[model samples]
Target: MLIEVRNIFFSYLPRTPFQVRALEGVSLTITQGESIGIVGRTGCGKSTLVQHFNGLLIPEEGQVLVEGVDTRVKGEALKAIRRKVGLVFQYPEDQFFEENVFQEIAFAPKNMGVEGKELEERVRWAMEMVGLDFATLRDKSPFELSGGQMRRVAIASILSMQPEVLVLDEPTAGLDPQGKRLILGKLRKLREEHALTLVIVSHSMEDLAQIVDRIVIMDRGKIAFDGPIRVAFSQGDFVKQFGIFPPVVSQVASLLRSRGFEINPGVLTPAELAEEIRVKILEKKEREHAGSKRGNWSVRPS
Candidate 1:
């Protein structure tokens, strides 16, 4: 397993009046090269769980293992776990400190002691991976770019470290439709090309439906569901209670089914729903045509 969380429990401030249990007995296992989506209402411990994966938060009770190594282990081993798991927090731009885009992206590699030719190559490759042209944007200030570009630069910074697992927390929190599409596309490409184990935390079921293979739904600091996206989304009542909206296509398919159509409920993308509707319409039209040709169609005379 790339990540393993067993009966984990964590609190913001233990043994205090303000103490809040952020996670309780949450267990999950993520294999290498798998894409997982974490979905839930606010304050459901999605952020807390991902933090454990990278050693950002140590478990107060239970264990978090990355690549079969316990994160609680001290020194170089813990540091190595951090290097293997690159976390991009919500609004990653807030983490940026470098003046120029090039420096911002290269910060991670530089910190890891990569220098000279190798460091330059990694920076350039990371920038290109995120669709930023080094020649065109490297000299520009990261703060000056649009919100989407800034997010990409932050991701590139993590990529420079070349982590095995990429954990993104609300990666597309604030963006227009086009911006969301572009960022999602870049993530998809990264998963395909690099086979990076990705754990995305988002409230957008529609976005996760389009990209992730598995969905982990968290509610009230506990995992409610962990399964394929289709299965997770099918529990309409459970999903609704968690304040998550099913993907548009799933809702549309449900409505069609209620209207006596045979549309499958597993359709997640607009493209898949469109194709199913088209096929159904075409099949209906073909049946009508056949009946008309056979003189089996009847009409009432006025």
Candidate 2:
């Protein structure tokens, strides 16, 4: 397993009136090279959970293991663990401190002790990976870019560290459709090319449906559902009860079924739903043709 959580429990405060249990005995295992999506309503501890994967938060009552090593074992090892699990927080632009895009992205590798030719190479590669033009944008101030570009620079900063597992918290929270698509496309390519394990904490059902192989729905600091994307979406009642919407395609299919359509329940994408509708129309036409032939035969019968 690339990551493992065993009987984990965490609280904001300990033994106080303000104490709130953020996580209650949540356990999960993520293998290497797998893409997992975490979805939940606001304040459901989704962000709290991914923070533990990189040692940002120590388990108050359980264990968090990365690559079979327990995170609680305090030492110089934690730094290496942090490098292995790169976290891009919500509104990552707010975390940028450098004056120029190049310095902002180079910060991580520099901190990791990469220098000289190695540092320049890592920064250039990271910028290119996130689709930033090195020669044109490197000297420009990070704050001068648009929101989408700033977000990409923030991501590139982490990529400079070259983490094995990339954990993104609401990566597309505030962006135009084109920006969202650009970031998602880059992430998909990175996962395929680098075999990077992606852990996305998002509320966007459409984005999750399109990218994630497995979906884990969290409710009230507990695992509500953990399975393949299709299986998780099939639990409509459970999902509705939690106030989370199924993928748009799933909802469309459900509505069509209610209206007496023979569409399959497994449709989870617009492309799949469109294809299903086309096939159904063809089938209906074929049935009408057969009916017309039968009526003509009856009229000719003596």
Candidate 3:
């Protein structure tokens, strides 16, 4: 396993009157080259859980291991884990502190002792990976860019670290449809070309459906559902209990089934749902044609 969480339990303000439990006996394992989505209602520990993946937060009990090394380790060991797992938080652009785009992306790799031409190349590659034009935007201040551009710059900064696993929280939040599509497209391409394991935390089921092969649904600080994306969304009613609606395609597919249409369950994408509907229509027509032929054969001397 690339990452393993062994029954971790965590809470805020420990031993205090206002303490709030954020995770309870939660265990999960993530493998290399897997794209997983974490979805849940607000305050359900989705963010808190992923924070442990990179050692940002240590559980009060149980263990979180990255490559079999305990996350609680100090110094270089933790830094190595951070480098291997890059996390882009929600509204990550708000954390930008560099004067220019190039500097912003170069910060991580530069801190890792990359310098001169090698650092520049890393920054350029990272920008390219996120669909940013290095030549046009390198010298520009990240704060001066549009919201979508800034988000891309933030992601590129993490990509510059050359992490084997990339974790993002609400990577597509607050963008227009076009911007969302651009970011998601870049992410899909990054997975295919770089083979980076991705763990995305998002409320948008539509976005998750397009990108992740597996879905991990959280509820009240615990994992409520863990399974294939298709299977998770197929249980529309069950998932709804966690305040999550299946993607539009899956909802439509379910509606069709409810109306006695032969649409299949587990339709995650629009294309898949459309294909199912088409097949069902064809089957209906074929059946009708066969019935007509039978009627004609049954007509004896009429």
Candidate 4:
């Protein structure tokens, strides 16, 4: 396992009356090159759980092991562990402080002691990964860029570290459809080309279905379900209880199944649902032809 969360239990504001149990005996594992989605309603501890992957938060009871190194260990061990996991918070663009785009993207790698031509190459590589041209956007002010470009800059800053695992919280939040598609599409290709592990916390079921292979559902400070994307979306009744919507196609399939139509609830994409409908229609037409040929039809009066 690249990372493992072994029966973790965590609470905020410990020992105070305001203490809130954020994680409750939660356990999970992530393999290298895996793309997983962490989803739940608001205040469901999704963000709190992902923070532990990079050693930002340690479990109060159990342990979070990243590449066999416990995040609870401090000093160089912890720093090394964090270097492998890059976290991009929600509204990450808001964290930008550099005056120029190149400086912004190079900030993290610079802090890690990379310098000179090597640092410049890292910045250029990261910008290119996010589809930003180094020459054109390098000297421009990050704050002057469009919202989508600004978000890309923030993401590149993390990528400059060349982390093995990339964790993003609400990555596409508050973006227009075009902006959302741009970021997600770039990330999809980046993960494949770099063989990087990706974990995203998202509220958009449709978006998650397009990019993630596994779905982890959290509820009430605990993991409710962790399975293949289709399996998680297949449980309409269960997910609905937690106010988590499955993919639109899954929802449509379930509605059809409930109406006595022959539909497999495991459908996750529009193409799958469309193919199922086509097959059913063909079967219906064939049955109707056979029935018509059986005997002379008698008209029934209503």
Which numbered prediction scores highest in TM-score against the true structure?
Answer: 3
Q: Which residue pairs collide in model 1, if any? A: none
For candidate 3, the C-alpha RMSD (Å) to the true structure equals: 2.2
TM-score-best of 1 and 4: 1
Question: What are the TM-scores, per candidate, against the unseen true structure?
Answer: 0.94, 0.92, 0.96, 0.92
lDDT of 1 by residue, 193-263 (tens): 88988999998888898789999989999998889998767557668877878887888888889899999
Residue 49 miss distance in model 1 (angstroms): 0.9
Task: Sort by lDDT, best first.
Answer: 3, 4, 1, 2
* Candidate 1 wrong stretches, greater than 4 Å: 289-302
1-302: candidate 4 lDDT, tens digit per residue = 99999999999999999999999999999999999999988999999999999989988999999999899888889888888999999999888888999899888889899999999999999999989999999999999998999889999999999999999999999999999999999999888788889999999998888889999999989988899988888888888888888877998999999999889878887988999999999998888788767765632244
Best by lDDT: 3
Off by over 4 Å in 4: 283-302
- Cα displacement (angstroms), candidate 2, residue 243, comes to 1.6
Cα lDDT tens digits, model 2, 217-236, are 89999988888887777567
Please identify which of the two predictions, 3 or 4, would achieve the higher lDDT against the true structure: 3
Deviation from native of the Cα of residue 266 in model 3, angstroms: 0.8
lDDT of each prediction vs. the true structure?
Answer: 0.90, 0.90, 0.94, 0.91
lDDT of residue 272 for candidate 3: 89
By lDDT, is 1 or 4 better? 4
Write the residue-wise lDDT of candidate 3 on 215-257 in tens digits.
Answer: 9999999999998999989898899999989888998888888
Clashing residue pairs for model 2:
none
Give the lDDT of residue 266 in candidate 1. 81
